[model samples]
Target: MANPVLLNNIDHKDLHVQTGRGAMFGDNVMSALTFPSEFRDIQACYPIVFRKADDGNFEAHALFGFQEGENLFLGMHGWEAPYVPLTIERQPFLIGTNGTELMVHVDLENPRISSSDGERVFLPHGGTTEYLERVNSTLLAIHQGLQQSRGFMAALLEYHLLESFAFDIELDDGSQYRLAGFYTINEERLSALAGAVLERLNRAGYLQPIYMVIAAMSNFRTLIERKNRVHAAQC
Candidate 1:
């Protein structure tokens, strides 16, 4: 469970966050929630898929692995990919809105949270540290990206562009895993879209990301290779 609290210089002046990636620090995720704004970078390294939220609403994500608590990108050397999702980049920090103002909240239970070492949250003079400033900017981007994602998802739903799909993987060890309950854009429907509809999507700034999602499906092969490498090493 997360113990989140509004960050304050007075209470957290000495707080520090350890920077790095690993499962112990909560990096062992099969997927990370992502927004259309990040499609380009995410597509370069991950398969962008859709998953149903608790309310049955569709949300986009960048898949990292096939099983629960698995992240093929994570290895003894750290994240293997050149691009890490912002959703993963923002660790131990979350955005909260105090009225109209956005505020940063820290998760106290996170392993990255420290006091004696790592990146400091505040300077010796009680001013915001550069590390905290970067975190603030990242939180703001995540907040805004999520807000825009809602409209993007709504448009996909309105056009009935989403389709349920499954992934059946046969590893080198002759073992198979069936991944289900996920969604993806229907390429047939996308290609059949009327010119006017395409133009509307383009004007809304969702067309490119839709294509990015499709292109990202190719990364499934990349994931399989990574998984095979890990399996081989274990063997």
Candidate 2:
């Protein structure tokens, strides 16, 4: 459970947050929410896919492993991937709404937070620290990106461009894991789109991310290699 509270200099002046990657820091995630704004970087490392929400809406995710709580990118050292998703990077801090204003909220229960070590939340003089400034930027980016993604996903759904896929992955040791319930772009549908429809998607700025999601499937092979290395090490 999260004990989120509005961040303030008086209450959180001495607060600090550890920025490290490990299971201890709650970094053992199979996937993280992603948006079109981050597709370029996310596509380079993770397989970008879509999943149907409980509300029947679609959302994008950057897959890290085949099962829940299994992050192949995590190791004894740190996150193996070059790009960490913004959703993961924004841990322990979140944007809270005060009427129409966005305020920063801190999760008191998060393991990353402390008062004696790591990056400080505020300066002694009651101003934001550099670390907090970066957090603010990350939160803002997430806010904007998520808002844009809703419409982008809606368009994809409207055009029937999203398709579900399942994969039975075999490791070097012959262990098999079947991945399911994830969605990807239907390249055939996209390619068959009418010129006018393509123009509309292009004008809406959804084309690039669409292609990026397709390109990200290539990283599945990389993920398989990482999974193989993990399995071999445990053997």
Residue-level lDDT of model 2, residues 48-85, one tens digit each, is 99998799888999999999999999988899878899
- List candidate 2 stretches off by more than 4 Å: none
List lDDT for all candidates, in order: 0.92, 0.94
Task: Give a tens-digit lDDT track for model 1, residues 122-233.
Answer: 9977999888889888888889999999999999999999999999999899978888989999999999999999999999999999999999999999999988888888
> lDDT of model 2 at residue 84?
94
Per candidate, the number of residue pairs that clash is 0, 0
Cα RMSD (Å) between model 1 and the true structure? 0.9
